[model samples]
Target: MKKLPIILSLLFLTLCCVSCKVGRFVYYNLANITDYKIFPSRPLVNDSIVFHYYTTEQDKAKVPKKINYNGSEVAFDDFLADNKTVAFLIIKNDTIQYEKYFNGYEQESIIASFSMAKSVTSILIGCALDDGFIKSVDEPVVNYVPELKDNGLEKVTIKHLLQMSSGIKCEESYINPFGDAATYYYGTDLRKALSKMKPEREPGTEFSYSSCDTQLLGLVLERSLKGETITEYLDEKIWKPLGMEYDASWSLDREKNGLEKTFCCINARARDFSKIGRLYLNKGNWNGKQIVSENWVEESTKPDTGLGNVDYYKYQWWLSSGGSYMAKGLLGQFIYVYPSKDLIIVRLGKNYGEVAWPELLTSLAENY
Candidate 1:
């Protein structure tokens, strides 16, 4: 009966492995719900950065009770109640006009940015280009990431990646436990995970929103910076200089020198997030300091290429009608910038429902 022991051992090992895989899947899939409680994150420290407090003139404004959506009016309070909105803040003329928090979220509560980090990564690329670290956006990504050479990615340029036109064969299905998005999101070795990717079509020929495109861009930034972590680079280049109030955090694939998930997951206070919108609204200028080049800001937000209809996507930023642009996240997180009206609106929430964001923002801009 010695074989009984062997069979039991084998069964035990199989069960253990299955359990581990299932645990990982559950953990990563539920990150949206649980990460605000437990997740490894790297701090974007605000060292010696002066806090730019918003001028409190809260009462000089009125919150619209209802907004029109698809020819029908939706109650703003009903929208918030149904959508799990945690925080919403609006800044105009360099002052806080309206701010509200729900679901026990406070002014100090740090909310996850999700895919909004993609735009932040794009900004870092701009900073790298401005500093001459990257010679040009048209330069082949292989120039920075040599390992991608000889692969189908040989011809993919930085601009292609930024615009989500890389045509990489990375499926972005969040519901699939074994898909590319989950692998990149939960897997520890980013380079290993990326090595398996193959180009689906000619780069710069089409547009497809894939988080791996930003992850590759992050890799380019990491390679170009010569051993500097993106967290450090951002803190020194943008956060510190722009005077972000609270220290922010970026989630990593694993602990200690692990790659930051540049496609998503940056947790920061709502007020500080507004500063990002303000920076873009000021055309990359922060109180007269050119944090990102004005030309870069202009080019990044405009649809220069006619691919993917070019009406919405531009260098990781989502464009809208009325010359408005925004950095949007998967679950209703948004930093909407209205340059014409000099308005910055920040919304952090779990779901947006059927709320017409552009119409709502346009109405708010008109009223304010």
Candidate 2:
């Protein structure tokens, strides 16, 4: 009888809170892999003309049977299994060398991209540039979003947001129920969350990784579009052109007429995710066609040590210490690319576990 009263109290409080972002966060608990089902999504329907890459399992490269990890040696297959990986793929020369799925996950199972969507957003930004929807990266963000002038964001640039040096004030903690990440993830109105944005310091002053930068970029992308949503733009430019094997969807802030959570939440299959790797591996050229400018692809992945920028990251893509880069996300999701060896590694997991994947991937690339 006492527990019933407590439960009813929580229910009443949840029903009464404005927006209910906090209540939704508590109700859903922490973010998980299958979030696609919990949230309504904008469909990313693939092209009718699909591109399929054949697999050559027998011609797979030799990987160490026993892998060394954080000073301890473990069986190579067991290592990925123990880390709760749902999908793992190693592609060489435009073919699948190794593919595995575990923990009730299959090849066709849909997996949420988490922050890997940031990299996809970066690609869309490049397309926006090519199509003349956006003039240049150096332009002040306020040119696209004048309403943010009073918020002290007039000095911020599109490049600044891409580089994560926008100096936007946001609490990035996923554990905090009141934090910006949780609110953005669970909130019904993304524009409402964006309207409350406040700057903490001068943009381009220091390197700071904030989801607010990416979310703001989404709004800019949204505003720049003529007669479409970001999801429609993605479908027309990337998904349909690239010929994705399956239909995917971008999760929205609401079930109907909502903006894409571009900072995260692109739900897709494993092989289809690898196609993104193949695109960049070919330097944004799919077959003989140029999907994005070659210069844009180079700038997006290459290290930049300029002021207020990081050599380890550029244009929402993470650069390795070596000649490799990745589209990384929360919970250890990765689209690691090693161009020197023509290798691409996709690892999607419940958590990253003990491995520092960037370093490990660098070492793994050396063998190829």
Candidate 3:
């Protein structure tokens, strides 16, 4: 009978070990959701978290017969069902051919953009430069945020931040509880968290993807615009000018800062997000207006670094195989553009676990 106790202990240990490994794969940290304090609140649009609204503008483009893609084939409906993808909009040539929302998602629901907002911020930066609000990406970041002038950040260039090449002391290991990503999200003052960082390497010497880099860029943009908010800049440059049907909102820190330009939580309609892709595909032109310089658009989408080519990040967009670029966010948010193919696809979802967003995107692109 003494073996009974040992057997029970062994069973408990086995169960604990099994749960830990399974939890690692299925559990979502979702620290940003909690850290941002985005409790259940009124959405900017409709009540749902995913929806679509067709623009009044007539469709002026054609649909492609077939899409080019790499990797294995996947059924669109099956993927949507299995992944719990909140929304999907496929624009081929120029007309939207396929759009669906699952799991009670509906039109006018403003799903959070997460990291996709970074690419949107990049577009706004291009507009700010074109309009002479900021002279160039080569300008020292401290020129705008004078508080950073004497700090080590003074040496960091705007381009460096955009390309995620800022050699700041940042570690983005999401799994590590003590890592910068978790600490930054959990902290009340994200900028204060950044302020505490001492440079571990020279600015722009190495490539390291850091959400703080984009947040700092947000601060710089706000400073350049004379304390104008990022939402204000976006409204002027893209949202209102592009004829966005409804108001979009950004969740901010405790200070009510409107410049959470990175790390997500942008609440906007699916169509509005799709417009961003269309704008890039059209080379920054919107309704006969040069919203952003074509030169900037071209340069911002091309691969800039040589460290690795598997996924080349340009500005805030990621360049994939076959001249495709996209703004991708955690949990499957995407704003993909293929200028050569004249295609754009915007997918928003909460598939943090149990789904392959990249693979699903590849499937959509293949069917395009």
Candidate with the greatest TM-score versus the true structure? 2
What is candidate 1's lDDT per residue for 299-366, written digit by digit as tens? 87886657543668899999876788899987688899888887888888866765666667666776
Best by lDDT: 2
lDDT of 3 at 111: 73
Per-residue C-alpha lDDT of model 3 across residues 1-368, encoded as one tens digit per residue: 99999988876775564323222222334433222234222223322322233332324433233332345355655556556677877776556676777777776676777788889888878888877889989898878766665566777889888888777777876667556765544444556665665566777667777887887787777777886667666766777667666667766654444235355567776877898888888898976988899998998888765532224788888887678889987667888887777778877776644565566565557555
RMSD to the true structure for each prediction, in A, is 4.1, 1.8, 7.2
The per-model lDDT (C-alpha) reads 0.80, 0.89, 0.68
Model 2 earns a TM-score of 0.95
Clashes of each: 0, 0, 5
Better of 1 and 2 by TM-score: 2
Query: Looking at model 3, which ten-residue stretch has the lowest summed lDDT?
Result: 39-48
How high is the lDDT of residue 244 in model 3? Answer: 67
Q: Tell me the spans in candidate 2 whose CA falls farther than 4 Å from its real position.
A: 1-8, 11-19
Pick out the ten consecutive residues of candidate 2 with the lowest summed lDDT.
56-65
**lDDT score, residue 188, model 2?**
92
TM-score of 1: 0.90
